[model samples]
Target: MRVGPVGVLVRPRAGVAGLVVAVALLGVAGVAVFSGSLDIAPARVLAALAGDGTRVETLVVVDRRLARTLAAVLVGFALGCAGALTQSITRNPIASPDILGVTTGAGFFAVLLITHPALLPGGSAMLAAAAITGGLVTTGGILALSWRAGFDGLRLILVGISVNAIGMAGVSWLLLRTDIDQAAVAMRWLTGSLSGARMPDVLLLAPFVLAAGLACAYLARDLAALRLGRSVAPALGTAPGRTEALALLVAVVLASGATAVAGPVAFAAFVAPQAAMRLFGTAGPPPLAGGLTGALLILAADLTAQRLPAELPVGVVTAVVGAPFLLYLLHRHRRRTSV
Candidate 1:
């Protein structure tokens, strides 16, 4: 049943799951903060956070770890929201920005500029902008192709795959033509490391996530109805075409902004919403739970990456988990279709 004056949804299960995931994120952040050479007492960590502790504690808590933690949280939040929006609109379990070639699109242009710096005269932030531009461009092309293919949900995914292949081919071309050193640098970014995340990156990415997230919230009611089917959504007072348009736009913006900051970190967009769907037991991807799950996944992966002996890129860790998940989903779909 709905609650109170505004008639807000009262999903106890989802609310509790969101709370738990959020708490887990905070706990991971805490661990990341207090995990350096200096052994600041547990009780004093708060003091450091407040800028009242000794220099070492303050440096450890506020300066070093806080930025990284915020970066992961924001990037993960963006991807999660984008994925939730995508899955809801497509009404497909396996659909996501990563799966649909949005991340690949984002990464391609970023690498394009990286491999040829002479084409652009800007800093890392501009590189991030290039990635956003690439995602938008790729999305437009995919939508055009999907329209030609009858605007089917599965058809859109197929179109996305084709576009993604072209983008990957372009990336390969750029890498091959570049010097080994430059290609090495570009490949490192393609692998999606959070090692370079700083306060500046967090500051730049925050507003984009906030604005797009609010837009997603506004589209929630529309998406919920659209999930029933385009024909049925109209009976529920939803504009099917408009809702789909807005949802796709917001998803692209969210996913692109996150990729811009995190170097197209893979699978957070694909895996987070699926995990949240299971955790909250929702018929569809719940936005809030998905966002929380994304944040937790990224933060945990980053923490794990740091603790590892070789210090792998964050995307590498996620791909290790996500690849199998994708295969499983495909196998399940195959079985159902066969039946």
Candidate 2:
């Protein structure tokens, strides 16, 4: 299907694939919520979801597992959409919130507040604000450094690497200054976990996620125009600068909200869009498919981590899975560029 002046090929099979992924995600989420250490049956889980389970089932499924599961889905969706937008804006398959220092920046600011609550008022709102601020500042710095005549993806990635190094150093310094217990807590949070994920945190972030999603939907046509190149974008009546800025804003909001709730989440942002593209056989980012892919990955990973001999952090599991995929992607990109 054509969009704007750019003829975007929307594969007929992509929608079917996305629907399949969504259904798979629900199945995985069910297993994740029901088949944990407590081992609630699927029937009970369903009943609890429908608000008709016994007290014990309700406590296990609705009270505890449901909140964590919902948090995962929301955060995963946010990260996935953020990743797609960032990659599209940069015209780089590998450009992700985590790779571009956005997640690192958010993590740094949130860690700072955690390590020293006296630095600011102690609340989730404060933490979320710090995350969003850090992400915007870091992204702005990357853009400033990368823009010579225009934004260059290679330069942006390199600058992001430098910024990420600095952010990690800052986090390390904070860890050093804090007590052992506090440092451990901070480290666990940095690795990402859905444990103790409360519904209130999810509720607080829902509005931001909804708003960003709506904004992204509205800007889809402009994004299609922008993909055709800066020269072509203006001819197509899309103000490249404004469109890019608004897209970046949406990405930042989504990433910051996810980070505020779920820490950095390792490579969820990076893997999601790439997986969607592969699944859909599309050149451009498939936002809906990407979000579903991300939610599925997170739920599966979280479930795997839970079922292991020793439960591991969800981030650790993702890193183990994603790092290899990242290497493969880099090799493929290198080969393509060389060719």
The regions of model 1 sitting more than 4 angstroms off are: 1-5, 37-48, 52-60, 335-339
Give the per-residue lDDT digits (tens) of candidate 1, residues 1-339.
555655657588877887788789989988987774467787788888887888977767776678888998989888998899888888987779987999889999999899999888998888878988999999998898889524577888899888888888999999999999999989988887887788888988899888877787788788889878989999999998888888888889888888888887878888899899888878788776688899899989988887898889899888887789878878988999999
Candidate 2 least-lDDT 10 residues: 6-15
Maximum-TM-score candidate: 1
Taken over the whole model, the C-alpha lDDT of each candidate is 0.85, 0.84
What is the clash count of model 1?
0
Give the TM-score comparing model 1 with the true structure, all chains together: 0.92
lDDT of 1 at 317: 87
